[model samples]
Target: MHSILESVKESPGFTTGLRLSDDDLVLVKNAISEHLANHLARIEPDKVPLLQTTALDMYHTIAGQLPHDKLLTRQSRILAQTAVDAIRTTSLFRQLESQLGAFEISDEENVGRESISIRLVRPGFDTDVGSLHADDWFWKLYDFPVPTGKRRVKIWIAICCEQGKSGLILCPNSHKRDWDYSVIERAGMSKPLLSPDENPDKQIFQSKPGDAVVFNYDLLHGGMVTRGERTRVSMEFTMLIPEDVYQH
Candidate 1:
């Protein structure tokens, strides 16, 4: 793992990333596409009218009806959960531990402590082009504090992205600094938001299908518009270890 991290560190972007093989990528993509299709199919015809609505409104409405504990019923949700679990227990995660330094998963019993969360982000159906504001606040509320020596990383997998579709864009290494929550609050007010250049040090990542990108939590990031004819689909998850490391 250290070798992988070292290799990635040698790059200017400070990101060591890889795409899933063609076969695996295809399988994952098919699974997600079918899952989403089924979820939409489950909606009553009368409700289909509502799905035409913007992403933010649709997400809020679906979120209200689908509790966090109940997200597993959807195929996309199940896949996302499985991916997170795999990373948590695999040698891949252990390699990350050595490269990033000691880390621990959040204690399940602790309230208000930063912990892992998985979310399914499907553009177009539940949101429109300008709905990026919602994610700005979402990341702010979930950020957990870490000691000076360690990094807080958030990982995302692009399970399904049609050719030329919009994927996620992230500023790499931006997590090395403290997050500026005031920017998020101000953006929520319909005020002018900072440009991506405001954080030039950040690297923007656009993934192919089945590609995974991991970055520091404090790193400024957001969804990008899908340029292709197809809708953009992806999953995001966060990981953090306690300062003591053994607490988990």
Candidate 2:
């Protein structure tokens, strides 16, 4: 895999960064565990410890770890915010700040931040999770206009995911084209934007705790069903170029 800087410079849509330090992972994992524990205080107790282990178990434990359980309600929101806060303090983010101009963490006011979402993909269980897609498609569905001048980026962190199995896949250099504009209504709503027969510039790689991938908001990407017993748990938030930074 190319260094994060090289990948971004080559395509700017997808780049995986250096491994997140043990300290960084600890801060994020603990925060998520505490918040989820608070939310689960009344529903389930045994599953609280599972949150620290892997995302698949956390979702399954809370939802009963059943094939039928698909509800990821309030706890998903908590995970998203907890992730956003933790990622903001990372050295990767610090590097992004210098490259993309100063950024504000996702908040209610920032249209970009509102798109933040938590993702948990489990093997043999597919229901409410995401499919092949880009963030801007849904943003436009809600009538949010894509930024015209300043660049916008998405920050993704894998809390309990690894290489292979059910990890995210991306169609590289897919963001720079105009074809999606006309077909987004039909194609952008689902996962795997292209068929295996289509021969796209597909890319997949391994990731570990604290690993992050920052890409253009317009890139075509989504998770795959894991092949292993472990589940893929991750969170992503949006970053917008600061107006002042562009002004200078």
Candidate 3:
């Protein structure tokens, strides 16, 4: 058996773990649900009784917000703080934090729940499924410089992902080699097209609440549309070992 980080290092750049207990997951999930419910109720107090669908509808309401909205940004920060507290209670997270030194959570654009990436994947809807792509590739394309001795990783926690729901797909061992993404077709900064020959082994993880998938941000990865009738929900956040950590 390999350690989680080792497995991720050897593979397409990701690993999933049920680090949080059932109770822990419930606490976090309830926090999110309550937060959304409160927001909805505050907005329309008279309609609070009518809005019974808290999970999918509440998620969509938050996800549909403009990223720059103060409410959205503040809620994202609150949710991130909630996630950090939940993850810290896990032994696995402590182990990684010890070994990795310190990780700074990213609060920048498209990095939080407000970006609609923390979505309710609906079946047969291209609206929900993100195209196959590497996030860091787009960052690089925009001239984001990643210095030596500093690395960033993204962790996505499943709040309610189930089997056959069309979860995340990643190309195995693709991160081991730095592909010439410039050679791939691209219309803009969003999705990068992969050549047929450039394809690698594809992998997907069936996740449940409290399960988390950690991956290199540079890895080829994206979500698939939900195939099951039940909606899938998840939240994502990134952590980077800042350059100062290497100086010590």
Identify the runs in model 2 with alpha carbons over 4 angstroms from their true place.
Answer: 1-12, 42-62, 65-71, 78-86, 107-116, 145-150, 180-199, 243-248
Candidate 2 to truth, TM: 0.71
* Reference-based lDDT, each prediction: 0.46, 0.58, 0.59
RMSD of 1: 8.1
Best by TM-score: 2
Q: Write the per-residue lDDT of candidate 1 for residues 1-248, one digit (tens) a residue.
A: 34434322333323546445666555554444444444554554444334434242134345444432333332325443343344455444554566556555442224334333334444453333232222324434445244454434456666556544566665555444444333434323322234543543433465766677655434456666655545555655445534333222
| Tens-place lDDT digits, model 3, residues 74-100 | 243345445456555665466567756
Query: Residue 151 in model 1: shift from native, Å?
Result: 6.9
Worst 10-residue lDDT window for candidate 2 reads: 183-192
Root-mean-square deviation (CA) per prediction: 8.1, 5.2, 5.6
Position 166, candidate 3: lDDT: 60
* Model 2, total clashes: 8
lDDT, ranked from best to worst: 3, 2, 1
Clashes of each: 8, 8, 1
Q: Name the 10 consecutive residues with the lowest summed lDDT in model 1.
A: 127-136
